[model samples]
Target: MRFVFGKQDLADSARRAEHCFLLTNGLGGFCSQTLTGGAARNDHALLMACTRAPNVRWNIVHRVEEELTRNGAATHLSTQTFAKGSPEEGWQNLCFAQVDGLPRWVYQWQGVQVEKELAMDWEQNTVALRYQLENPGDTPCTLTVTPWLQFVPKGKNLRKTQTFTLRGNRVTAAGLDLTVRTNGQLTPCPLGWQTLYYPCDAPDGRRKTGLTAACLQVVCTVAPGSRQTLDLVFTLEKTAPPAARVLRQADRRCRLWERQGGFRATAARQLAQAGAAFIARRDSTGGKTILAGYPFFEDWGRDTMIALPGCTLSTGRYAEAKSILETFLQYEQDGLMPNLFPEGKTAPMYNTVDAALLFIRDVWLYARYTGDLDFVRRAWPVMERIVAAYRSGTRFGIHMEPDGLIAAGQGLDQVTWMDVRIGEILPTPRHGKPVEINAYWYNALRMLAELAATLELDGRDYAALADRVRESFRAAFWREEAGCLRDVISGTGQDEQIRCNQIWAVAQPFPLLDPGQEARVVATVQRELYTPVGLRTLAPGDPAFHPVYGGPQKERDLAYHQGTVWPFPLGAFYLAYLKVNGHSAAARRQVAHWLTALEPALREGCVGQLPEIYDGENPTASRGCFAQAWSVGELLRVYEALERSVTDFFDHK
Candidate 1:
């Protein structure tokens, strides 16, 4: 399912007046927002929001403009309904607005002349929103505009009921086990919400449900000219029959404080409705493939592989994962998982280094997570074919190394755009012996061998091959000159300047480096490349460093990897650090600190949910795309990894 909104910025003038929706394929509704001339171009605030609530169909109504009606006395014109249309498209205009690129709505309400424009930004793991309300009606409008984020799981769109009890002025789902005490206060809930973390927080946050439906009470009030906001946060659980029931029960709270029960219930409906939305999306794919995120990213081998463990695995979506594998395999023409399916076609791109190898990792894990060997056998041929193609050479020059290593691409393969500063792809030796390609190669072979034997297939030579690569990888990539793994070797020479590429060596599917080397590399990255937000693509000592960011072209290229930081890799580095060092209390604390810094990003109106890239420079500006798929996926994965460690410790002890 998808959340639609407008604008990529926080305070865009157009965003201050628009409407949109987070659409499931079945819910890509359209709307119109009046643009403020000059505000349209420079203020290209694209709307972005993210949700892991299973099976949701979100269609939001954003506040964009004002509607006027003659007063009963026929004396003056004042605001009436904020919504601009009848139920049908031809009959009326859907009061839709694009706050930048985000979708929001000019919601209809029975009140004086009161209106609000809502937007969201990513604060690291949490979601944050900005609300603006205006009252232009006489006698003031008690504009009770409730935010409706919908998540549907089945059938057609059916409206649900909602209720809201009150304590003071603060408003919340009256039945939630959360405490609600409103005193004109605008603050986040202390419900241990850090679970919104990209790295799933294992049993850590999942276990933090509020007291019960009756645990707390609160409300919010917006007087004329005085727009008030309440940062309403809810920790959504996945769809279990039990969870669906609880959410539906919670959704029954219709009015809280001055707002009606329907408003609060409308908000909660988005959470519970996710399951139906999921089903609808699955159906919309016409029984073909389930795209990961809607209205944006389609199912790419890379994005799907990276997101599977967290996006699907964490939620017990094994069937979906297997199907995704089948879908990619069905379309495996030149071998590489298509960089992305072209907007409306089945054609794919084979220019990436990480996707196919990652698929091997996913299949292995799927087998392990479910202990399904038959699934492995079913997938074995697909894997073998892919491996064969990679060993032979395909689109990006990917092939097996004579040294038993894996390699892809050529001069400046830019195999990854992590930090392509100056529009220059780092000479990452697409030919032979890149660290991650081999790590993945090693892992894929080893895992495949183990699976092969489990299914009584020819697994003999594979183990020996994996061992050789694993041993030689440690020999080749380790650079005594720089404590980190060599970023690349010039096919014939050593070009081992420490770079972010080495970070992958630590986190990739295979552990080619011995534990000691892994630890040392982790330490070096933690010290040299790691930042509070993420790791810089290049070390400061490198001439390639370019933290000062600028506009597109000259500026965008300069800031890319030349010196900027990637949040996704940061998640990997953090987990790798935990994995190598073991999860000490201090380590977990560090994890919390590094990730929590992104809290501000969740504040509102950033694309999708998170920023795609960060500045390489010191106050390290977040550069690149906002709401990147992998950025969110990896972060969530890291959180889960850390939490699982703690859980395992407790379980074993």
Candidate 2:
């Protein structure tokens, strides 16, 4: 899981793809087929036209939709529904990637030495790659691959002709079949191998092919040990106007590794810089986490805090983390910082127990790592407010019980990103003292104790509070029979059914349980809930554990979070086990072996670029959308921790 300075240099990737001009960062966007509108260039990519369901349903809703764009005019695409799963759901290896440093689980490079792997790096205006591909066969093979490009809005002036430095010939374009069959099956058709073809200066580059946005495919025929360079440029002009979400802005660079798994085209350095600069640039006084996308969320404490270790600590972006803390505390209600601010809202949502607490832990950790207490002092008040809010009663019934355990509850929107229920929280009734939230809460208070002592604040209360919550959590939520913490507390009732989310209590920074309890959780989940694609949401014995991740409308919707296995959660659970168990020589080797499980999906896109979830049945197939932010985020975190463990060994030596 540890990543080294990959020898595969971005600037030197023998096989590579580059855009002529930078594509805008698509965070939040409004889109028509080709053109996109967003808060800024930071909106999500509009590179590819999105086709979700089968088109033949002709509900006008399911009629496959695509938007065409040019500076002058844009085209709308109408295509049939999703690539169906007639035989079964799977992704085909469309091309061999020239990129490197992908998860070791994917892409078993036959001839490429581990040292000769691909490398990726990005600059403000450019992304570079250098990777080695080894062909075992004597015959030269044509490597056909397509980089997945996502397009976001440039403006209504969607159509424009642009050129770039080109090294390879265009591959033939083929219609992407996306039809879904009965039983929630998808893509039964045999994929047509795309013929190589190039685009002419039609108003929009892809207008001739009737594509609104998506990556283009290309091919390279190389002899064994041969390497080729990929280069291209993009031209964009303002068309009619930007769609609603797009804000006027300068060219933006997006750092991709914050999540580490996705349609990554390299954004780590710029993100680090922007985040570092945010504090100096801010008109405000408080610390805040960097906003992933802009305008909607003023600061999402969870994402901000989670990103702290990598975005700030690892990348040398300390000042911004300090500034982020300064900005985040202003929204402290009672004790909690705001989770998210909807558009046009001065107030923010306090829908989470973990985020504010996590902020405190992040701030404390930041101070420790950077040797900065000025940062600690700046963050003290808001952190205090967050601590105080958890103790005092707030909305969603957040409070400290007499038993000393922290308790919060019952709001539907309260679930973390794995949330599936729309309108209201799904009535599946997961509530009261969710395992992970409290673990974060416990960790935060303990961290606050260190911060307080370091800064001469009242250190006693933090330590005392931490102990009390620990004692209370152990007494109330632990499921002696299952040997793991219950998922939640429903009024006086504790949910004893095992759930993946419960792993947090045992696996997080401050697990509530002792080593024995921790071991039980690790063993139980590994035996019952673990799957190749991801961890199951619930153990199969639970009535609610839906084995099939897909079905007709309602079934699919219900299954979204129910029993569907999510790969990201497994990352945390794995690390928690490792941390609790201590690394055995045997464990490190197993870590290497287990990681290979993720490889099949990465190169082939079988579950496609790491899907958000998977079914709980045999095959444990990937489900949900192709890319989910946290799904990748957790993987990155897992790998990061793993890599750190290895580096720690070297450092000690």
Candidate 3:
């Protein structure tokens, strides 16, 4: 799906800033900027290179300053926000902007038409900009492009004392080298220490200003009544590829990814293309991993497992799915997976309780989709060890109870996905047996039993354990009074607030609740937590519910899980919705209609991508990370589920 922005869409600077575009290399490096060609966030850069595979990233090139001169008249073609002055309103001259495979912008002013297209080289820290200048009038035109440089680690502020040296077309700063290649003439024009403002960071009390320097400029001329093409390329490597070749390779890869899932809907195909951005190489493990979200999050264990089925398996990238699973398995300890691998750190943090269980579920899904029994056989022992560790005990006080229900979280550790700790305060403290964790536990037990049987091994033990958990879960979690299951069950009491977590009990591969109970759980969730975009963390009537998510760190953390609406859970909700309704024509039609409601959202924040979250009260505004892996993954899963529903209904009919 190509998103085009005309003059009207670019007229509003605020809205245009919120609508950005992203282009990622396979090594977790990306180039992103607003639709109007401005850096709204500190993370926005033309060349954010990853020195390491997925973590050690540096912002080498922040933004390019472009100006077009026609018959002695100068028109600024670049937009920027400065610290103390008004913003450069170059967007006024932008006639059209589009995000197809890459970002393209067209500026038409005074009979001079200049089109700019940008792309990043695959698997390399390189960015290319191709300009096509068409001068129809009797006067010639000149296009001047200047690149602003900041050789700092990703998210770090550039210092005034930072030294930079330029020689010919090469630049050296902070012990890093950058080679500039352009068809136009290169001039060494040094403009030092310019402070740029990031309006998006101000609300969160983050560093809103950053310093960058203009070290080099490129100039090209187009004669009257003729068209001229210019190419500008930047790379950390010794050499840079041609702009046209880089663009062709990037477009070919995206087109192949878009066709991978065989999705009939345009949105689903676009999401399939977007899913490739999250799958990146892990230098530490020598394998592939899925980034949790773009612009902030790293490779998280729980998020990777949750997203693998849709991001890789659903898109028929089976090898990547297996590789990601193996990558996590390489770090598994005591039957527990690492909660996250910190950026630039070799060791992984093992703090999550659900990642290991979710690992088993993903393994089952991999087998179900690809019919790869060999992979399952190799993974069986680790899966058994995980079960054994949980059966006895693991880190953070996670253990199976006497009644066969799994329990986790202790001390200051927030084990589940709603994990947010402010100092000693644990906001949204779901320290007991979280509803989704147990749901995953039950599903893992059943999956193990099935896998054992499939592998022709003794399966009685796992089946019996699953039965025990099923009986214990129904007795412990079901809330007869509330017509739904409790969010978390503990020895202290039941945290009976309605949340999106309970939907998993019915949505997992193996349903833990009975038919009537599943229907009631689905009904209660739809009535209380459902929104057009996502499901709220907590119901509105609860006192702890936070209607909006904003402000400083503390306020955002407090509302992070209190009531923030997340899109990932809606995938499970739709699956359960279809299951409870028996995948009838009406039900499938309703789900397809609901999925269509998300089409407008694709063009809202990041074109062709879903965001990490939205506000609980007013969900129109996209919040948190602009592009999220699990959000796109889950939406892909939902589309796959809808397609399957259609096929099954017809087959039965």
Candidate 4:
């Protein structure tokens, strides 16, 4: 799916800056910049290297300042928009921009064309930038590329370094021993600290001022009626000179997408390829880990489990799925899965309540998809340990209640997924039995029982436990007055707020609710919480609902789950909707229509991918991470399911 744009698309600077493209090297290193030209945010860099395999990232090179000179006339193809004013306006000359496997841009002035394309090597932390200049004018054109260097770690502002060493075509810094080489002629330039402003960082209270240093300028000249190509490579170690091999890697990636059931549709293919970016190679663990999102977020256990099926299983990377599950299983603590795997550290944080239960569910899905009983046998002991840990007791006061339902959360620990705290106050305080947590618990128990039965092991105990939980769930969570299940059942009473969490009851495999109740839950959710982008975290009528999700950290935390719309839950909502409607042709058609809203979204914000969230108000605008793993993964999963239903219908007919 080539997301193509023309001059009209790149005419506006703000629009061009907002629509960005991403390219990743499997090692978690990546290259991203706006279509307009220069880096829009501090996170946008030509080479954001992962010094460690899937963690410990640093922004080595920020952006390049390009200039085209001919006959004593010069034109800048790069723009830097600071607070005072932009020093250059090169966006107007940008003729076209397209992003498929690679992001390519073309700038034309007086019949002279300069094209820039970026690609990253799959195995190493290397990025190759290819520049082609075609001179159709009477005189020759000289293009000078001065790359802005910032050897700062992720989230840290660039600082002035005392040492800037340049030798021939290679340049290295004091603290950062980076290698910058190109085939074009390189001249040593005066090194000085240049101040650059980041508009995207200002809102987040991050460092808006960036100090960049340029040590060398790469110049390539094109004769009249001739074209010249230059390859510039950046890597930690000097290996073979780039042969434009990154394009071959990009081709292989696109082919992987086509093989992984992506040839069905444009959106499916785009999502399938986008999903692959999140599964980074874990060099430290010798396995794999799912990055939660791009530009921010790390390898989170809960997010990995939640994103496993859609990212790996549905995307036809089953081995990667197994590796991820295996990696998480190795870190299981007292039957609990780690919520986060901190960078540069072996210690894991096991604070989330749902990750363990979700891990069991993910394993069941993995076995069902691959039909690999051997892997299940290897994983069965871990699953049993998880159930035992939850049944007996675990950290954060997480244990099964007397009523057969699971209850989690301590005095200060917000263990559930809606976990957001502003100092001492919990915004979405789910201290008792959360609706989705119990649903996951019931599903985990039933799936474990099924797995045991499939393996011909003792399964009656888990089956009985699932039965008891089902009975307890129906009796406690179903609120007759509201017609939907309560959000959470606490000591005081049931909180019947119109939230999207209850949809899991009907969405999961072992649904606790009956058909009529399931239909009612879907109806209530669609009526109140559903939106074109996704379901709102809270209903509009609720007093606690915050329509917008912005401002300081405190204000953002207050509105995070109170009303922000998240795309991940909509995947479950569609699943419940399809199940309730019997997965008929009408249900399939409705699902297809509902997905049309996201079709435009693929073209908008973060081209060819979905955003993590949006505001809860009408006309929902994309916010948070530009390209989210589960957001794209969930859409991919649902699209695959819809296509499967259509195929199944034809096969039966």
Candidate 5:
């Protein structure tokens, strides 16, 4: 999808800043900034290079400062927000912005039209900026581009002055080397530090201002009524490839990805392409992994399992999906998957209870989608270990109770996805049997039974265990008063909170709830937590519900899962909604209508990508990570399901 914004769209700096664009290199490195060509967040960079695959990133090139001079008249074509006073306001000259294969910006001022396009090399830590300058007037125009350098690690602000060693066109600082290449004339004039402000991060109490310096400059001149093209490439490699070649390679890869799913809808096709941003290489495992979110999150176990089906399987990336599953399986310990691999660390953290169960479900899905029984046979031992570990006992007191319900979490360890801790305070403490955890547990058992049966293994044990889990789950968590399942049930008491967790009971491959109960659960969620963009974590009227998700770290973490709206759950909600309604024409039409409400969201936060979350109360503004993997994955799954439903409906006719 070619997303184009006009002058009117770029008129408001704040709105334009919200409409950002992101480009990833499948190595966890990315280039992102606002459509106005300014850095709104400290993480926004021209080259946020991943020195190590999937993590250990650094901000090599912050941004480029562009100036167009026509007949001694200078027009600033770059925008930067300063910590003090007003912004640079170079957005005034930005006439057009387009996000196609590459992000392009066109600036027209005084008969000089300069179109800038940015691209990143595949699997490499390199970024290239190409400029096409046109001078229609009788005077020659000069375009000067200067790159601001930041040698700090990703998300770290440059607090101290850096000593740089410039040898030829290469600048070395902070134990990192950056080679600057340009087709235009290069000048080694170092522009000193400037404090840039990040308005979007002010509420988080994070470092909102960072210092950056211009280490190199490029100058290109176009004659009267003539056109000239200039290329500025930055890399850590020994030599920089041609900017045009990098752009072509990037564009070709994008086209190949766009053709993957053959999705009928334009939104689905766009989402299919956007989902590729999260699939990154894992050097530790020497396999593929799905990143949880861009600019903040890394490859997480639960998130990868939740996102694999849509981002990979649905997109016809079966090999990568299998590789991702294997990557997590290799890190499994005592039937537990690693919650996350810490940045710049080889040791994986095994703290999540749901990731293992979800891993089993993903394995089942991978087999179901690709019919790869050989792969499943190879993974059978790990799957059996996971089930056995959970059934007997595992870390964090995770074990199946006498009644066949999965119990997890001990002490202050936040195990589930709502895992947020503020000092010693656990805001959304769901240590006991979380509703979704049991649902995933039940589904895992049933999937293991089905896979075992398919592989000619004795499956009666799993089937009987699944039966017990279903019966015990209904008896323990079902709440006739709320017409839905409880959030979490513990020895203390049953936490009767109207949360989105119940949606998974019906949304999973093997639902534990009856049809009538599932319909009521969907209806209750629709009435209480449903929104156009996502589902709220907690329902309104609850004292603990936080409508707005903002403030300092403590306040934000307190409100993180209290009532934040997460888009990933909406995928499950829609699927369950269709399932309970029997996938009728009316139901399909309603689901399509509900999904249509999200089309504007695609253009809201990250141009063509879905955001991690929105505010619970007024969800017009997107919060948290701008580009989320599960958010796009789930929605794409729903879109694909809807398309298949329509196809099957017509095929029968």
Candidate 6:
């Protein structure tokens, strides 16, 4: 899908920043900047390289500034925000901005129009930006391209230890090597600590300073009435800059992403390509990993399992999915999956309750889609250990209760995916038998039972355990007065707050709720939690509901699960909607309309991707990560679901 922007869209800083574009290498490195070709965050870079595959990342080049000189008048084609305001009004010269395969920006001034395209190699830590000048007015112009270098670790500010030395076209700063190769005259420029501001980081209560140490200017003269193109290459490696042919090849690599996804619908196709950005290959281990989000967040186990189906299965990347599962299987501790793979040399943290269960469900779905029985048999041993560990009680006091439902968490541990713990306060303290965990628990048991039977193994025990869990789950979580399942049944009390978590009861492949109960749960969720983009975390009627998600760190964390709208949960809502409505034509039509409402977001925010969240009250303004994994994954999953029904309709006819 094409995301087109005009002059008016560029003039507004907030609007321009909201519409960001991302170009990623399969090794967890990426290039991101505003549509106006400006650095919006410290993480917005021309070459954010993965020193270690998918984890140890460093922001190499923050941005590239383009200056065009017409006669004596010079126009800066780059925009930046200082401690004051953006003095460089280059955005006014922007004629159009779009990203079909690569990010392309068109700038017109006097009669000179220059189209700048940014693309990266699919597997290399290299970024290439080509500027082709169309000077129809017959005016000769000198175009200078200078790349701003921010040689520091990702998500960190450049400190006093920062050093930059320029030799010819090569610049080395703090052990990070960057080579600037261009057709134009390269002049080494040693700049020290150029302070850049990040308006996006203020709400999250982070240091907003982006420090750049140096820039290398590539000066070239463009002849009038003729198309003159200049190629600028930035790489972490010592190799020379690639030729213009590699630029076209990079475009092909991007297009191949969409063709491989095999989705005919516009949103699905766009999201499928966007989903490809998160599936990075491990450089050290040679396995696939899923990045949680852009600009921040590394590979996390929970996000990986939650995002696996949409990012891989829906996009028809089954081998990558298998690799991802195997990668996490190697990191499994006790019966729990690692919560996160810490950057650098830190050990993986295993503190989550749902990732392992979600992993089982993902494995079952993977086999069902690919019909890979052998793979299932191979993964069966790991699944068996995960189930046994959970049943006997693993980390964080996770074990099956006498009531047959799983109980977990104690002290300061906030598990079960509502896991936002700020200091001693847990925003959504679901520290006991969370409704969704039990739903996944039941689903996992049922899947294991079925898989065992299919493989001629003992299935009766698992089947009995699943049946017992379902009965206990209904009794413990079903709130008769509320007309919906309770959010969590804990030692403290049953949280009766209407939450999106209960949707899982009817949404899972092996549903636990009865027909009437499922309909009630779906209707309740639709009435209270549904939004055009996603489902609200909490109902508006709740006293704890925080409509806006902003302010300091504590405020943002408190509001995170209070009332923020998460697009991922909408996937479950859609499944529940379809299940209750019996996959009817009317339900499909309504689901299609809801899906259509999210289409404009493809062009509006984080171009070709969806945001992580939106304000509970005003959802039109997207907050949090501009490009989220589960956000894109869940949307793709729902789109695939609707597409399957359409296919079935034709087949029955």
**Best model number under TM-score:** 3
- Kindly list the per-residue Cα lDDT of model 3 for residues 1-653, writing each as its tens digit: 88899879867767867888989998989999988888889999999999998988999999998989977789888888899876778888998899887899999889788899999998899999999999999988899998999999999988878888999899999999999999999998856667898887788777889988987899999988999999999999888899899988988988999998899989999999999999999998899999888788888899999889889988999999999999988888999999888755456799999999999989988888888999999899999999999999999989999989888999899899989999999887887778899989988888898889899999888889989998888998899988899889865443878999999988887778888999999999999999878999999998989999989999999999888999999988988898888877899899899998788999998888899999998899888889999999988988987775433311110
Model 2, 1-653: lDDT tens per residue? 12212223112211111101112122221111101111112211223221211000100000112222223332221111111222100001112122222211112223322111111111111111122344454555433332322222222212223111112222122222211111111111222221111121121122222212222333334465554432222112112122111211221122233332221212222223223221212223322344432111223556666655545555545565566666666666767666664433245677766777777777766776578887678778788777777787666777877766667755565545444565663735555666677778887887788677888778788888888888888887777886677777666442876778777776566556778887888888887788766788778887777877554445676776667787767766767667666766566567656766766544322112345566776643344433333444445445545545633311110
Between candidates 2 and 5, name the one with more favorable TM-score.
Answer: 5
Please identify which of the two predictions, 1 or 6, would achieve the higher TM-score against the true structure.
Answer: 6
Model 2, residue 273: distance off in Å is: 15
lDDT of 4 by residue, 28-104 (tens): 88888877667778888888888787878888888888888989999888877765544667777888888876788
Relative to the unseen true structure, what is the C-alpha lDDT of residue 379 in candidate 4, on a scale of 0 to 100?
Answer: 89
Q: For model 4, what is the C-alpha lDDT against the true structure?
A: 0.82
Give the runs in model 2 whose Cα sits over 4 Å from its true position: 1-301, 307-327, 344-347, 411-418, 422-425, 491-494, 551-554, 604-609, 618-621, 646-653
TM-score of 4: 0.96
Q: How close is candidate 5 to the true structure, as a TM-score?
A: 0.97
List per-prediction Cα lDDT, in the order shown: 0.47, 0.45, 0.89, 0.82, 0.87, 0.84
Give the TM-scores of the predictions, in the order they appear: 0.62, 0.60, 0.98, 0.96, 0.97, 0.97
**Which of 3 and 4 is the better model by lDDT?**
3
For 485-562, candidate 1 gives per-residue lDDT tens digits of 876655555355567778777776456677788889999998888876677777888776777655545555645656
**Who is ahead in lDDT, 5 or 6?**
5
How big is the positional error of residue 133 in model 3, measured in Å on the Cα after superposition? 0.3
Candidate 5 regions with alpha-carbon error over 4 angstroms? 343-346, 491-494, 646-653
Model 1 stretches with alpha carbons more than 4 Å out = 1-63, 67-299, 343-346, 411-431, 491-494, 604-608, 619-621, 646-653
lDDT of 6 by residue, 1-653 (tens): 88888878766778866678988888889999888877777678888988888978888888877789988899988877766554566888988888896888888999888888878876778888788888776668889887777778888777657777888777888787788778878987657456788777755787777777655689888787777888888887768547476578877876777776677888788888889999998754579999988867788899999999999998889999999998987888898898888765778898899999999999988887788889889889889998899898998989989888998888899887788999988878888899999999998998899899888999888899998998999888887777799998876653878999999888887768778888999999999999989899999988999999988888999999998999899988987788788888899889988888887777776888888889998788778888889998988888887877533211110
Which pairs clash inside model 3? none
